[model samples]
Target: MTRAILEPVDADIDPRVLRDIYGQFPSGVAAVCALVDGSPVGMAVSSFTSVSVQPPLVSVCIANTSTTWPVLRAGRRLGVSVLGEAHEEACRRLAARTDDRFRGLDLHVSGNGAVLVDGAPAWLDCSVEAEYPAGDHTVVLLRIAGFRIDPRARPLIFHRSGFRQLVER
Candidate 1:
């Protein structure tokens, strides 16, 4: 089978237009959190992805201007909670610019300072393995140390600038 070949556009792409085009594909949402200075710091990211299995590596791309990433990165370990379909509110709260991101959410703090959100479909305790600058965002490589999964949970999704859930066919 042959793939379609497209011609390149002559004009520069608009960020908003590019984002809208990229949003056509759905992605699962995850909360990246850690206990920093006795406070839980977290953020919702849709760019989380599995990188490798041999080293149990995962990755998340965070904007360079994010204040939360700096705090969360300083921790010895970071908690990656794959938000379930029921966590739409929790996801939004985590993404907010409030003093306390865990205000109304159920969470558990690990001995290593990873803050896991309760009811998440999956949770992973990881350490920052590597980081690289990718344009305006930073690519964070996480080396998973430990993890847990709840097979029954459906993951929360982000699509076209809206929250969504996986559907069973």
Candidate 2:
């Protein structure tokens, strides 16, 4: 048996190199949305993760330059939709820097203004609990008020800078 030695790169790595390295890890896509002034405002994020179960907290990283975040953060409640395998187009649409992000997408707006994708595998009604400034991004902590899960739906996976599907062994 043999093992190859690996070298550590400099701390100030190029952003493209960093992205390429980070893309090696697969992640689930989430659509964070809310109803603002009778319209759906949303963005697709691959950095969504569950933080604390006891306190019912989740976190999503938003780029500091994101214009949508400022608008969405002002909402009373936000909906985090764990997108399904069938939502590739919807995810692309939401991620685009366009005005009509919700166009042609099926959605449900809760009484509290959380706008969720209709067939998402999971949905969480959350409010912004806290936000921390990170380099070029903001880590938003959300307090989960309510949630629902559809066991049968398969989640949309992001890997190697593209959308992917799960394969069972």
Candidate 3:
């Protein structure tokens, strides 16, 4: 077995280089959304992850400067939809800085007011469990209330700052 050597990092790290380095790891994209003030508020996140199974916890990182996170956190429940491979356009639309983020997409709203995107591979209905500061972004911990998965769909992958589809070998 070969062991890799480790090196110490410098204090000054270029944000662009850091982003590029992080982008090397492919991750699934998810639409984090909620109904706020009688409307749907959402944002696309590549940082969604499952944290715990005992309490059904999941998390998504939101930028500290995000205007949408404020509105989303005010809602009782938040929705997380794992985008499908065919949802590249929808993901772009959801991430755009526009008034109507949910403008031309099929949606499903839960009784607690989580707005879920249609055709997503999976959906998670959650409530904010906790939040912690993490550099320029806020790590939001969500406690899952309910969830569903579609067997026929595949997740949308974000790699090197672009959308990618997985090929079955």
Candidate 4:
């Protein structure tokens, strides 16, 4: 059978269409947090990935329009929490544009000021390594100084513009 030709994407591509296409690929949600002025400031990011093993580096993409990122990045250290299945509400709160994002949540603050969600599957204490400007977003590289994991916990997944739970067969 012959394959049909597909249209080439252009710079003027619709953002909604791009978002819908991106949402089709499932990804783990992460809470990137740090203590700012003795308060926990954080945001949820689905565009998080491990970049390097030798240097223990990870990456998270933040929208250029994000107001929280500027303040969060100023902190000496940041906590990257791989949100678990039970963290749907937490993720929502973190992503919301509210004054108190960490309200009604269990948290742990490292000595270096990395604020991590207590029940998350994994936590990485990291510092900003580098930042690169991309189209409408900034790709941030983080250097992991320390990390922890819970073997039994399941990660929260983001797909099709919604939260999803893992179903093991």
Candidate 5:
């Protein structure tokens, strides 16, 4: 049986320590994109996850203070791009808070105008389903409308404190 990971008590723990401990688990990198008022907005996230298979659902969380998030969550379809090793630059661009995320990026619009990252390992065309506040962030759930997997590309992975290419086991 699984036990509680953290107790509801006054305990001291450094956030950086927590992040380092948690980051030990390797995770795939993803970028969530949406267009607000005709301007493309995006954010790089290592927290993307598949929530449900029956409903074709996926979720990504964004910090409440994120300037790019509100623009992306404003009621429009968004693209979920699972990055490949070749996408390191794209990830950096999207992750930067003050830089042009799309500069030097080769992307295009899909049916609902999501800024799809070209040639990603996988791309999901989805519409926002719901959002809920979670502590310092909001988790946005999406209903996957469609997806395309690039059979030729290797998926990107994040571990410790950096990116890595996923190799065959």
Candidate 6:
């Protein structure tokens, strides 16, 4: 089998034209996870953000064609693991469709059994509040149930299809 990168569509053809363009700005990686039956289902993403403060809401988008997103979205509860400098391997593993993405990854469950990935800069255990279709992706809005921030760990970043670190000014 063979594959080739598709040619770019017109400026207004796809709303997600900005998606590939947005890679110019370095973005942090995170794992959006939920428990399916007794096992963990997760997807690595760079498109997550806190959307609200008073209500403590966060959001992430998953491609409509993603097989993992459907399974992970089945539950009412989830955990968002914000990757740290040490979690590059974990990020790569989860982003692929290979066996045992959790292999060799240190993890533990929160009081609610939400998976808190070790060595992350932050973790958010949440209840999925809403989900809506947006172009070719599904935008998930969640209400935070619990959270942890690790000041000792620096957030990992991605830019222009590559993992990167910011230089101090």
TM per model? 0.94, 0.95, 0.95, 0.97, 0.90, 0.87
lDDT of 4 by residue, 46-110 (tens): 99999999989999999999999999998889999999999999999999999888888999999
Q: Across residues 36-101, which tens digit of lDDT does each residue of candidate 6 receive?
A: 787888889998988999899999988999999777777657889999888888999999998698
Cα error, residue 17 of model 6, in Å, equals 7.0
Candidate 1 lDDT by residue in tens digits, 1-169: 9999975655677788879988998999999999888988889999999999998999999999998888789998999999999999988888999886788899998999999999998999999999999998999999999999999988999999999867679
The lDDT of each candidate is 0.92, 0.96, 0.93, 0.96, 0.86, 0.85
Error of 6 at 43 (Å): 0.8
TM-score: model 6 vs. ground truth? 0.87
Query: Would you list the rank order by TM-score, best first?
Result: 4, 2, 3, 1, 5, 6
Who wins the TM-score comparison?
4
lDDT by residue (tens digit), candidate 2, 1-169: 8998976789787889889989999999999999888888999999999999999999999999999999999888999999999999999999999988888999998889999998999999999999999999999999999999999999999999999999999
Q: Which residue pairs overlap in candidate 4's backbone?
A: none
Q: Candidate 5: lDDT of 102?
A: 90
Instruction: Show where candidate 4 strays beyond 4 Å.
Output: none
lDDT value, residue 87 of candidate 4: 96
List ranges where model 6 is wrong by over 4 Å: 1-20
